[model samples]
Target chain A: DTAVSQTPKYLVTQMGNDKSIKCEQNLGHDTMYWYKQDSKKFLKIMFSYNNKELIINETVPNRFSPKSPDKAHLNLHINSLELGDSAVYFCASSQDVWGVSSYNSPLHFGNGTRLTVT
Target chain B: SQQGEEDPQALSIQEGENATMNCSYKTSINNLQWYRQNSGRGLVHLILIRSNEREKHSGRLRVTLDTSKKSSSLLITASRAADTASYFCATDHLYGNKLVFGAGTILRVKS
Candidate 1:
């Protein structure tokens, strides 16, 4: 079974359209994250949730919002998407949120959602 | 801002050859991790080396971390055609839950 899974592996939408991507982890991890990989393959953290609590929110635009309904799921909702939002979005999870014991707690990532705005 | 920067944005090698990628970060970290991403796919965790460790090995992969220099290197020996993918280095900082990732190094192994 896939430890982490994201729905809508590929998404294409016109500009100004809103979209949402869903992520779920069966690894029983406490922390989940959302990352965006741009055309240049630069991956950047957008948000993180620890046990359904917002833990990390980068300086991403207001259009991007992350919601965790429960410990096992985190979803991303983008409003009025722009052309620059075209990229691959990945969902990842880890057993712990602290880095103290993180050496052994590597992240497990989902296959990713490819979003393209025309 | 990117937490780490990987050298050689792209690398091409023949099968059976060794491929090495270097990563340099700007902050103190508790551990550094290596992840692999195939085209249009989610990343796969490869290995992690703690800040206190200088070197680590797993199967055909070797990872080195230098805390003082804030740098790390990943070596994949006897690369296979299937090994062709983008490799990324990520850092887990001492204070945050987020793992900062570097711009990936794309490796193409020709058979």
Candidate 2:
């Protein structure tokens, strides 16, 4: 079974349109994250949720909103998508390990959602 | 801003050769991890080296961490065509819960 899964593997829409990408995890992890990979292949963290609570919010624009309905689900919705929004969005989950030795927790990622804004 | 930056954005090697990629971070870290992402697949964790540990090995993969230099390296021995993928280095900061990833190194192993 896939540990982390994201829906809408491919998305192509016109600029100014709205879109949503859904992500779900079954690894029983308490922490989930959203990462965006640009054309340059620079992977950057966009947001993170721990047990349905928003934990980390990067400098992403307000047009990108992340909603976590539960501990296992985190969805990303983009309003008024722009041409610069064309990129692959990845969803990942990991155990909520904090403090010392927190880096040992390996992240499980989804295949990713490829979004294209024409 | 990205905390980690990988050297040699792209690399090409023949089958049976070894490939090495290096990463340098700006801040102190609890651990540094190496991940592999196949063409259209998600990133898979390959190895993790703690700040206190200098070297770690898993199968054909070897990882080394230098906290004093804030850098890490991932080496794959006897690489295969199937090993062609993008390798990324992620750092877990001492003050944050997120993993800051590098730009990635694209490795092409020609069989």
Candidate 3:
């Protein structure tokens, strides 16, 4: 079974349209994260949720909002997307929020959702 | 800000040859990890080395961590064509839970 999965593997939209990506993890992890990978293949953290609580917000614009209904699911909604919003969004999960303590628990990533804004 | 910076953004090598990638981080880290991502796929965890540990080995993969230098290296031996992928280093802070990833090194192993 796929431990982590995200919907809408590919998204192509206009410049001003809004869209959402859904992510789910079956690993029973407490920490989930949203990451953005640009064309240059630089992966950057956008948001992180620990057991449905917002823990890290990495200076991302307000246009991008992450909602975690529960510890198993985390969704991202992009509002008024711009041309620069085009990138690959990945969903990842770990055992807990503290990476140091969870020595053997590395992040489990899902196949990314590629979004393109014209 | 991105903490880890990897050397040689791209590399190409023949099958059976070894590939090495180096990563340098700005701050102190509790542990360092290496991940691999193939084309059109998600990142896969390769190995992790703690700050107190100097080196670790997993099958054909070898990882080295130097806390004093705030740097790490990943070495893959007897690489095959299937080993062609982007390798990334992620550093986990001593106090925080987040993992900062480096710009990956793309490896192309020609069989």
The TM-score between candidate 2 and the true structure equals 0.96
Candidate 3: DockQ?
0.64
Query: Over all chains combined, what TM-score does candidate 1 have?
Result: 0.95
The sequence of per-residue lDDT tens digits that candidate 1 reaches over residues A1-117 is: 889999989999999999999999999999999999888888888998989999789899999999999999999999999999999999999987754464537889999999999
Ten residues in sequence with the least summed lDDT for candidate 2 chain A: A95-104
RMSD of 2: 1.4
Q: Is candidate 1 or candidate 2 better by DockQ?
A: 2
Instruction: Compose the digit string of candidate 3's lDDT tens values, residues A1-118.
Output: 8999999999999988989999999999999999999999999989999999998898899999999999999999999999999999999999867653645358999999999999
lDDT tens digits, residue span B12-101, model 2 = 999999999999999888889999999878899999888899999999999999999889999999999999999999998888767889
Runs in model 2 with CA error above 4 Å? A97-104
Docking class of 3: medium
lDDT of 1 by residue, B2-102 (tens): 38999889999999999999999987888899999998788899998888899999999999998888899999999999999999999987776678889
True contacts kept of each: 0.88, 0.78, 0.64
Rank the models by DockQ, top first. Answer: 2, 1, 3
Report lDDT (Cα) of residue B107, candidate 2.
98
- Looking only at chain B, model 3 earns a TM-score of 0.96
For model 2, report DockQ.
Answer: 0.73
